[model samples]
Target: MTESSIEANYNRAKLEADKVDLLIAEALENGCSFLVEAGAGSGKTYSLNQAAAWVQENKWAEYRKNAQSAVCITYTNAAVEVIKERLPENSPVLPRTIHAFAWEAIKQYQSFLVKTVTENLDYMPDEGDFARVDEVRYTLGNRYRENGVQYLYHDDVLKLFCELLDNGKFRRMFADRYPLILIDEYQDSYGPIVEKFVEYFIEPGAAPQFGFFGDAWQTIYQSNKACGAISSDWLKVIRKGSNFRSAPRIVRLLNDIRPDLPQTSAIDGFEGEVVVITNDDYSGSRRNDRNFKGELPPDVLRERLDEVTGLIRGNVLPEETTKTLMITHKVLASQQGYDELLAIIGDALRDEEDVFLIFFKDVVEPVYRALCESDHAGLFEALGVKRYPINKKSDKIRWHELRRSLESARNSKAIDVVNAVVGSGLVPIPPKIEGWMSLYRGDSSTLYASSASIGQYLGLDYQQFVAAIEFLQPDASFSTEHGVKGEEYDNVVFAIGRGWNLYQFDVYAPMITGQVPIPSGKQASFERNRNLFYVCCSRPRKRLFFFVSIPLSLEFRSFLHDLAGEENCYTYGDFLREWPERTIAACVKNGAS
Candidate 1:
């Protein structure tokens, strides 16, 4: 807390940042490939943007002389937009998702791909293959026609591009087209595909420079193995250790909890409060009882809500600034988890419908209704028909006449329907409609099945989606740990419980306190919970309160006391005893204010 201590922390953090800057400079100046293991709050995005800017400033002149542009690939569209906005207006950096980049390649090589596949393979064109590109479904086998061009499936487009990269000629051409390639969130990239890309493009020195930036510890997605598979030996690998987001106290808490990760420090010298409340008195006995299955009892859930309510009322400044984080590991296990969550959060909730519901409302129902009404104009308008040419020569065409002609031609297959709609030339194929066609191209039964009739089949998905959406609302006081990543608040009340399938506080307590190693079969569960807890705890800018469903072990309790100070650690009973009734009701009704 002293000025000297703050100065020391700031100096140490500066050294770490300088080290990262040096590594980036070395890679950019030497035209070498590099990978950075950026820890939480290490400013990974900033580093990536700097690298991109360096590429544009240093390597872009030569690349432009060769008619090529630098490429920056990221995992999410939002990230791409952010990076795009940060780069200079005339910068050569072309920010895109891996899929979007693959689509561009497919468009450029469509003719060549048509000739090569047709000449080299035994292609069978089915009725469904009418005018589509060779559909390369990764899970499904590749389908190509021996003669004509077809639209490429999303996965197939990536597959063909990877295959083309394997060819020496295509690899050189691609390298020439993209002299510098920087991948953000590289740890989340698909393993096999990235491996192939590295082998053909990076390792062979095909591209002038390459950069991969991401935090391996934050690899929460299932396909994380690919991140580890990337060869660290060939690239200049750097580990960035300073924390620029969280307070110093939070940084220290993360250090204790996730000591396995790279060492980190809070560069900003900000100090904040960390509170730990044990549920041992309430749920202690049931902690180790695996046989005790199902949702937590209502009394226990109510007690948790009461504790959160009290904290929000007393500790949260402006009360409305409180953010409560809960976890639902098995949202679809049963509706019980979501129901309990809703009941606990009460009125502080806002929900959004899932993608399927939105898609059904926006596209499917309209198209289906138009088809049934035999209104060609209505159908075309619903399809968002804009620039494609129509064959009728007349301003309007009767649906009955068109349907009769199509039926007489025996084009009744689902693919036939898609082709008629798409090939009609009256409407340009939109991405959403194309996606729908892809989903039911081979089987149209689902297309004709009305949403009303198929409600049962969609019931669970719809419920989960709505719950997730509500939990994610910015104005809502409550959210799931997974939903609150990358979000920060003045006060955060994190609830740890069992309904989330594997996230039992009893098991997590031991692992967190170093009293027990993560069990063999439960490594995945343990790591997930660890990451979730880390994310939730680090979200509070000023104060953090944890509410565990079960009691902490003696060792875990002592560990918490030491990490967050004895005054900050309390039993749930003690918390209730100290807080007044009105505060509790306020939290339960409208959140902690």
Candidate 2:
């Protein structure tokens, strides 16, 4: 990768963001619903801000007269800020998350909301359902109760609102409140809610004018299609053609991948390095062997990523300039030597009664991280000091001795750490772990992973167990492609294989590379994989590298060479040849503390 360093000159985009903003301004003037197909790094937010400002300036008088404020509906709070910041001071434009927007419509209809929650949904409260929304204590709403408190999931918000769309008066009242509605990142909008919005509002010429703004190629958040009937021809189509992120060559690769919505780079003459690394020769079996599964075995996969990352840091790009992006957290956990923890973690993580989870999260993790940082205050905090002081009152001098003992505990086995935590009499053991006293006494080796793996997991080395738990924490060294969405860097190390059930790159590669025709039945899935791949590829400003594990057919491999250029197509051996002399560099040092 040293040979593929980022280019020296970073010529900023020559194209004006005003081009799209002006188009959006004019589109709003026409008074028709429109969808802006803003591509990656096209400054879609800038366009949105500009459009909202235009609405505020030109339509404020009309909205004020009608007693309505235009609403900018987006998915995340961060996006709401992006739209809200650029609006005029005390502007009539109100930017809100879809959840907040739905809450506004349904909060006044308390009786109706309660009816929808109790009658339509399955989560019936144990003490009988709430009579009012104010009475219902909501952490998030879906389930009727959680931890003896009435609450729900986030999905419940959307579900309740979707149910309300069936009522003509609710739709009319919502339209009366908001004469203009703009949904940014509309592609990832909730499916059922967005569908009902189309049915009740957009399709039938409702009062509010609708504007959907997002790139279909960047809709990688969902496994299936996100924006449903919004793609229909009823809405006026607008394409923001300029890409202000990647260099000229990187844009060319993207254009080849997606010809339908081709991009014009803001850089007129800037060149970029595009390197593709593939392991076509490695022989490793999938844990569950099947033709559909493409990910290498966990250990083998770790080896592959480490070698590739080493080459990338020493040769291709420096650790400071490059960001490593994987497909999922599980994939990254495997690369970090902690994926084994993910198996037990996948099942009922919210179950408070699970002894393993309680021990890991509370006692082990907090103590482990505190010791690593050499913070005695943090250690004491984990021991439930301060507001909840150390329960077992021994000699106060013992706190000093415990620090040294706990620091050395990392060298002991995992079961030993658990026993020390429980036996030290420094902290009261949870009732759940006490209940499992019989299981803990048994030999871990005798317990099967399928039935009794908690003991077996506890039997691992404490160092390894702590490391696994740390990997489960948010690590900046490696990230999922989804995490880096709408983010750009000087260079990127994009590792592509398959870890998730739906992200089948093996099937998607041939379709994009022209080895086979795209199937109609798998069209949604193809788009899903393609959108993710495109999202990863288009993140780098000066240099882009793709390290793929799924062995591609010869024809598709050659197609990659042709697409990326022969000069940039790299083999695994090229990386291995230089590895013996170089030290591996981490993208980020990820000690959990």
Candidate 3:
């Protein structure tokens, strides 16, 4: 193409983007709010950053006159960091997580928080119970207090905010202080609180002209608390149609699944690889007939995952470019070669009382230490082993790799090694760990102590916990659902299967295909899988592959083909033996596109 034509096309695209910007600017200028439904790869962060800069450039005078700041509320601290990094050094945008924003908004109103927690959440008899309460604090867990902290929590803050809503002072504070409120990832926000927030600002003349920026389809993390179909009429809903992250082919697939908010890829000409490998030969009722289903057992599932991974890595996406999103953590521990350890230690992490705290504890401190550098004797005694499992050449090779990589860990930040394990006195023991520890241990005492040490050693930090979780997760790097949210990769191998009691892909397929109507009662189940599937599919910037282990009937196969293009469909045998050559590798010869 001629330089003139190229420049002309670029100008046209820029003009198109500017039109959306103008609309948003006009909305804010006119004291109106909007809901930007950003589709897959639509550059939600870019749009938000642009809006923040635009408001600062255009409305800084008003903000200064009112002695207020433009607030950007995000769901996660990581997101807040992204927003802050995108804005200028002294940018006017005040980006904060919802919790921080909420606390800062009403931290001074301790009496109201105490009243709300005592009467409403704690179910205490009277507000006088908190007469000795020195201060109000917020936590991520259920609301409580030890000393005079009077800690509030996720829901407590909301409850208190709701109670404070009745106070005319709080309402005026909202009207006076925050002149603009831009909420990112609003879909993942708590539904009731979102409704209350929107209702307050959604009115024609509400102050702090607010806008919500998020996609309902990307509402996997908090689907239970998802603000469903948040009435677009009240909220001037706008769809950002440009997908800056994905290739043309990936965007098409995304749009096919999400017909409501179809996106147009911004890339000039990028056709990435897209494939859906299905298996039909796996007959039904294989694992004890219980309502007719066929599932790839842990062993077979591991094999297939490895097979497809190798294929994609060799032919389509590079190993570094590919990311595997494992859906079921239940089998992951076992499949990843740590289920035995997880069995005893997982139970010990926390009793049924406080699950999230233990989850937080698993969040490593300094770095991810995949293997603990325990003394050989402790290792052997922990697992009650007399000899190592280096019988086979392959075992010897892996054992050597483990030794070399054992020195490697997650991050570099030094943390005080609290509760440091001197020996294998923390790790839980099963036959696998027992055998593993046996290699290092001299006798049974060390083998049993290994189990004792498992919990504290792994709880070193999130990095360590993640390392331990996916330790050998099949000799391949894997990403957890929570860990990989909002992250992008060149290619994604999303494993979908009949695992996790929470999801029902077997039933979801029929409902989606129109063969079996999903009852209203089961809507949540359908949404749970649907949102997760969408989130996974949209993660890959270049290529997307699905490793479905559950039964895929003819209808489901057709549905998948329709969603991912028939040219992209492949049978298990075809992918294994004669998988079609990728056009992406053939055409794009240079760097990472």
lDDT of each: 0.61, 0.69, 0.63
Looking at model 3, which ten-residue stretch has the lowest summed lDDT? 413-422
How good is model 3 by TM-score? 0.75
Ranking by TM-score: 2, 3, 1
TM-score against truth, every candidate: 0.67, 0.77, 0.75
Off by over 4 Å in 1: 1-15, 111-149, 201-208, 223-231, 260-270, 283-295, 329-472, 500-514, 518-526, 551-567, 578-593
lDDT, candidate 2, 1-593, per-residue tens: 33223321222232445666776777789777889988787778878877887888899998888889989998788878877777776788999988888877676676765555556545455453355434333345445643434465666666678878898888888888888899888888888887886777777766678888898778877643366326655578888777788777888888888787777777533466677777766665655554326667777777777777665556533433667888876677567655565555544332333466557667767865775686668878777766534445564345445555666665876666667666566656778666555566764444534544657666656665555555444434567777788788877888878777777665676677577689879888887888888888888886787787777777667667877787666567765764324322322221110
Error of 3 at 103 (Å): 1.2
**Winner by TM-score:** 2
Clashing pairs counted in every model: 9, 9, 32
**Whole-structure CA lDDT of model 1:** 0.61
The full ranking of all candidates by lDDT, starting with the best, is 2, 3, 1
At residue 313, what lDDT does model 2 achieve?
Answer: 58
Q: Give lDDT tens digits, candidate 3, residues 1-593.
A: 86655345334444656677677777777767788888777767777888898887987776777688889998878878888887777666799987788778888877776655555545332323344566777765445565666666566666566666656678778768887889888887767766666666566456767788888777776434567557746667778777777777788877776777767666554466677887655553344334224667667667777777777776653444777777655555545544544554564422322222232234221111323443555445444457753468875455445443333433311111221221212333235433533443443233233354433333334343444434433344566554566888888987766546666555575465455677889887887767777788788877788777776776677677777778777778777775645443554452343
TM-score of 1: 0.67
Please list the residue runs of candidate 3 whose C-alpha ends up more than 4 Å from where it truly belongs after superposition. Answer: 3-15, 88-91, 121-131, 139-143, 146-148, 222-224, 281-285, 288-293, 317-320, 345-476, 481-483, 509-520, 580-593
